[model samples]
Target: MTKGRPGENPAERPRAAVMEDVAELAGVSAMTVSRVLNAPEKVRPETRARVLAAVRELDYRPNSAARVLVTGRSGVLGVVCFDTTLYGPASTLFGIEQAARDSDYLVSIASLPALNRRWITRGIDRLRSQSVDGVIVVAPHESAAEGLRNLPPGLPVVDVGGGADLPVPVAAVDQFAGAARATRHLLSLGHRTVWHLSGPPNWIDASGRVAGWRSVLEAEGREIPEPLVGDWTAHSGYEIGKRLAREPGVTAIFVANDHMAMGVLRALRETGRRVPEDVSVVGFDDVPEAAYFWPPLTTVRQNFGEVGRQAFQLLLDRIAGMEGEARRMVEPELVVRESTGVSP
Candidate 1:
């Protein structure tokens, strides 16, 4: 194999492998080698296999820039997301990469510092400048979803659970449904009233959770207490949890995220309350550590990978000039564990 070792017997610059080298090794014209790489069907199987064998031996990779010039397609997809290192967005990003690589497309990313209309518009503009065939915006905020209206007409965009009333297509977890299910589970457990510790107000996910929790309470004709807000941080959860733990009717709580739930667990312990005895807690985003938390958190599981994969699928359909925009919604499941139990 001519896969030269980079630092072997160091020289000014080791020779770079090229298609001509592969062509020469295969005993074929350069055009035949090109056909083998781009349109192998046009060449006889035997000849194509021979060219490919030489290509492997020489460690040859075609210049993507040159290939794009010839084929109008960059074979690249752009993903736009927010700056935070939150699990949902990060996992969704990972899912996008996995799906893109599997589909033989390269990925480019643009992370916005905030999730506002102007910032989202700027993020889209930056990706478009890279000549991306399409973009998938990992927008979990209501405002960011609204910004999709300003997208360049027919740019083939997909919003990853952005929110309601978006002009573009969406692929997302049904945040409202997931939250409602969690609330219902607690209500069914005989808790008279279930309290909520929500994420930041601007995020659609946080708002949806609050709405779901409130809807169930209202539906049952139970008292609808105001939701305590957190910034999706364990620290925020701890802060709000301390306050909730002191309240008389805070026997059950549905937190917005798992990280926050951990904090609440600590707060409850500090306040002389025993889990599943005096209080029960449920969290969202079944993070890996949720199971290891004291009392093993009960939570909602958002299929983040599914959200990402479906988003890519919707983007693919749009990029191919399909007739209409399609919004794909994935439902979440309620996971019961030690943290949840029959009301004390």
Candidate 2:
């Protein structure tokens, strides 16, 4: 009977004491007792019950810190993200959080200022201090991918969107396919050519969408014009739309995201360009407001939620040393609405 320190009773020394007692009473090793606590499925049912009963009798509570020390896993996932206010990133994070909750894992979010290497490295180091099991990065910029290349070896990582080349798994929406679909849909409505208003060139999603749009036009032998670029903002879209409204031979337009499309809509209305009649419009990322736009926007709906879930799942798989491809792409769907009409 060893005496505990001040303020500690020998009967209730701590979780370690209780676990040791349980192991002795159940005639099992301490490692076996720990296995039963952490992964009950690994232990035989009868043995598991015996250990559990012993735990109850001794009033034993498992020590999470001790478990982490033994397993070298914190059971926590770190998420590094940017654009927290944006629809795509926010929705995706929600899905990831939900999935993590379902799996009994905790998430710690580190919002990076930008996708620069310094910021990303800092975020990673911060998460590492917490001893997270793995990390999920949710920036979809070219710079983000470049930053990921600098990470140390053997750390499991999952990329949500950033076109950044990743060492671990990567999950994202198929922006190119979605853009192609949008373009083809416009052409089908008898528009000779569909103009494009792109997001910042640095974003991987923006680049993919632009590529898809160009590929469709080039395949049909339609003349491709210089794409108007915006900064993924409604105001930028509006500015580009104003200029586009005055451009000769422009009848249909494909904007990169819904927010910009709203701005385009405003510009079109102010310029007296009747939507779907004089000029049809299609946008990407069917945001909540896309439906409520004066005329519902015909836009591509990206599966951001699915991206988040898949990103987390992929990271978990990598952490568990499962065999699978490191890259995954989610497909986006085109939603037809009042914004597009048959060419007169």
Candidate 3:
């Protein structure tokens, strides 16, 4: 066996690199190292460079627990969302993660099976246990509003696609405006009145869209046709579309989402009705696949990325003990396409 160096234990494991090691290596105080890691703007360029170089050389990772103890922040944000299989929620979550990454913050996500008060609270608790600086809840269902009202005190919370009366700050795409635009677009094409294929009633987004669509029809003194509710799935849209396809009065249809709109298109095609000819269609959520639907869909584009960024910013503000706007809404755009045209 090789002999060990004097007083050196060769069998002992090496000590892990720490912030103090980086500070010593960079010829700076531990405070300077902390500043460089947490608030680099406060450190001089030369000092920051030296600290960064030392950090790389030592492969030093700031101890999150120790940093949280010292600074009261973990640099980790939490996201509580539901069933990411759907496009809207999934895209919103993706946007939040992207924004967090750009800001050099880590994201810890808690995806729940349901949007009820029980599930939402549990999700928040799980994130809180992980020492997240703040949390953004992406539950857009009516059931979640009640849960939001009952959250534990003092933690910064932001809601995405939630109701306006929420106790916490809110950042969401203007679903009402988007739905209204879709309804108005169909009406602009000279359709007598637009019919609506809405999402489930329990969803806040669905209710907002319904209200917007209904508002337009009522304001214009047009016939207010009852909306058919779907489960925000293409299958639901297809089933509902089949019923609408048989009705001659259904000249224009405003769907709550693109997936359902695609279903409607299929139903119309199978029923021998040419889109934008015998019947026009408009949908919300300009999902990527919307443009490829046989007759490309004319839909409302929700700026989910902007909403996510705004939500993250709002959380940051709250975490910093700043009081600002309670709500921020990203405007949705109307994208006209082949699916909608003048009434024949």
Alpha-carbon shift of residue 146 in model 2 (angstroms): 1.5
Full-model lDDT, candidate 3: 0.91
Q: Per-residue lDDT tens digits of candidate 1, residues 1-344? A: 65454566475465666778789889999999999987889999999999999999878989877777777678899998995387898999888889998999888999998778899899899988877889999978877866787789758888887777788888988888999999999999999989999999998899988988899899999988888899989999999889988987788999999999999999999999889889999999999889999989999998999889999988888888885757788999999999998898
Deviation of model 3 at 241, angstroms: 0.7
Off by over 4 Å in 2: 1-35, 39-61, 164-166, 323-325
Global Cα RMSD, each model = 3.9, 3.6, 3.3
Question: What residue runs in model 3 are displaced by over 4 Å at the alpha carbon?
Answer: 1-8, 23-54
Full-model lDDT for every candidate:
0.88, 0.87, 0.91
* Local lDDT at 198 for model 1: 94
- Highest lDDT: give the candidate number: 3
Better candidate number, 2 or 3, judged by lDDT: 3
Question: Per-residue CA lDDT of candidate 3, range 1-344, in tens?
Answer: 53443236758555668888899999999999989987999999999999999999989988878878877888899999998877877888888889999988999999997778999999999999988999999989997888887878778899999987888899998898988899898898899999999999999999999999999999999999999999999999999999999999889999999999999999999999999899999989899988999899999999888888899989989998987558998999999999998987
lDDT of 2 by residue, 1-344 (tens): 55563247756544345567789888898878988987899999999999888888777877778778877988899988887898988998998998999998999999997778789888888998888898898888877776688776667888887563466578999999999999999999999999999999988989999999999999999999899999999999899999998875789999999999999999988998889788999999999778889789999999888999999889889888885557788989999999998875
- For model 2, the local distance difference test gives 0.87
Candidate 2 TM-score, true structure as reference: 0.86
